[model samples]
Target: MQIYTVGGAVRDRLLGLSVKDRDHVVVGSTPEAMVALGYRPVGKDFPVFLHPESHEEYALARTERKTAKGYKGFVIHADPEVTLEQDLARRDLTINAIAEAENGQLIDPYHGLADIEARVFRHVSPAFSEDPVRILRVARFAARFTDFTLADETLTLMRQMVEEGEVDALVPERVWQELARGLMEAKPSRMFEVLRACGALQRILPELDQLFGVPQTAKYHPEVDTGLHIMLVIDYAAAQGFSLPIRFAALTHDLGKGTTPKDVLPRHIGHEERSVKLLQQVVKRMRVPNDCKDLGLVVARFHGKVHQVCEMRAATVLTFLQETDALRQPQRFKDFLSACEADARGRTGFEQQELPYFQLLLDILKLVQSVDAGAIAQAQTDPSRIKDAVFAARVHTMEQHYQFPLSQSVTGGSG
Candidate 1:
């Protein structure tokens, strides 16, 4: 049997990046031979084994053909004669099709090393159209590799695939896996642009695509359109190296604007609430972790709250915090501030006079940091006094800084 390192391990090693996991493909090896050699059979649908000593996965050389629809519709043929080149031809991207022999020789029939040096991403073969998931992978690669551009032929192939209704073959889980990886990249905004250009975003997230060219009242938004604003926010968020959930929060923070009335001055009076609902639906569909979904919802809901708290009383602020769980953890509050700041900074057209209001909100959130619900809940002091003091301080700070009419800001009569 001839064993060779394949896929990401070989690609990453060539890129001078540290390889985390290594996958081996065994050519001319039968399942029975593997079993006899003490390898443990672990794969269900295909002939794969775990190395007895290293515990790494080793799959027998196999060829596949599309037998039905979607990624799982492939019919795999595992035999002892499948050549290494034959196996490489079925990979999604050229860069991932290269292989490293046991003696450290690189095999690149697709000229993957040339593409890598030129910062280009190309499909391994026309067969890339078979599995629609490859489109998402291409977008993810674009997001991760800042300098890479898709070749014209590859772009044409992707467009043709989209036109042929291949996107419908994708499952939500696979879509989210690629999307999550893109969001976690160093420059996630690139992912959106690539997806948009490739027609993937329109199929998977039409709501997001609707943001393109939508006018925001120039007085508040100097940026050209909502889509550009969203991209800027995502870029800024990624530059800060925020967590995946927070980055998602920044990416989707303004999603509600697409559904709001275009004629209105702000055109987004209750968009935060709408965005929360939209995020819930999306997160549920994508099967995201519950904690991440909750975090995303909270960030989207309160993204605009800071700007409206000018005249709020301490009691009102405390009550709001209690209800929203914003102060449930230090990290959550920090994420809230980051989301708000990214939203504020992403817009280009607001009058310079409005900067103070944004600064005021930031200052107030920072000033009340020690007395937030999380702290109050952990403190051993008297509950009633602690709540009363925090509430009063919040109100007094708002009045001193913003001159906001407390009576109008708070729901109940201000004490």
Candidate 2:
């Protein structure tokens, strides 16, 4: 049996990127033979094994046939007769179809090296249309390799797949998985752009897709387009190396703006409430994780209010903090602030501007936490009044802090 390093490991190495994991393809090897040699069986749908020593994944070279709809509808054939070229042909992109021999010889039956050098993404074969997940994968790759462009033929093929209703076949979990990964990439907007170009974005995320042409109030959003603003927000989140929840929040914070009445033109009054409702629909539809969904919900509901924090009264700010559960879950509150900061700095000419509200909120949170809630609760004669007392105490503390010299107290707050 001949083992060769394949797919991403080979592709990243050729591009001078840091390879994180290595996947191997074992040609001319059977499951029985692999077991006899000490490889542990791991794959459920295909012949895959874990190396006894390195614990890396090793799959027997195989060819697959499309047997039904969606990505799961594949018939696999793995035997001693399966060639390395045949296994390579099944990959989604030409750049990922390259393999490396044990002797350090590069195998490029599909001219993957040429495509990699040209910084382009091209389909391996006509079989690329068989898997709907490839559309997400190609879009994600565009986000990761920011400088790379999609080949015209590949884009056409992706568009054809979308038109054929391939993207709609993707499961919710799989769609979320790809979207979450794409959002974490260096330039996540590219992923959405590629999806939009291929018509897949409209199928998977119609709310986000509709935002592209929708105009926003020019004074508030210099970018003017609600969709472009969201893209800028997510890209800023990525550039800041923020966590997944923050990025997701940034992506969904403006969904309500997309549904604004054209009669209202650029104005999006009460879009925050609209955003919260739409975010819930998206969260449920995508089966988004609780952490991401929770954060997205708060950001969507209060992001507009958050942007106006500097002007809010002490009582209003305290109410906002209480409503968001920021006092109890400080980390999530910090993440919420981060998402809002991304939104603020996402506008054109605002990229490098400082967000004083971010640090201001943190300082307010610190001051609120400093309040002796236990003492205030114990002082309350009526148990029902305990929550009100604690809230009042926190608000009182914030009011007192506001009376101090701005620079003498919490670093960024205004008097």
- For all the candidates, what are their Cα RMSDs to the real structure? 5.6, 2.8
Question: Where does candidate 2 stray beyond 4 Å?
Answer: 404-415
Question: How badly does each model clash, as a count of residue pairs?
Answer: 4, 0
31-67, model 1: which lDDT tens digit per residue? 9999999999999889989999999999999989998
Candidate 1: stretches off by over 4 Å: 347-415
Task: List model 2 lDDT by residue over 1-415, tens digit each.
Answer: 9999999999998889999999999999899999999999999999999999999999999999999889999999998999999999999999999999999999999998899989999999999999999999999999999989999999999999999998888999999999999999999999999999999999999988998989887766788888898899999999999999999999999898889899997888888899999999999999999999999999898887766666677888888888999989999999998998888888887787667667878899999999888888888889999988887888788887784223322222100
Quantify all predictions' global Cα lDDT against the true fold. Answer: 0.78, 0.89
Worst 10 residues of 2 by lDDT: 406-415
**Structure candidate 2, residue pairs in collision:** none
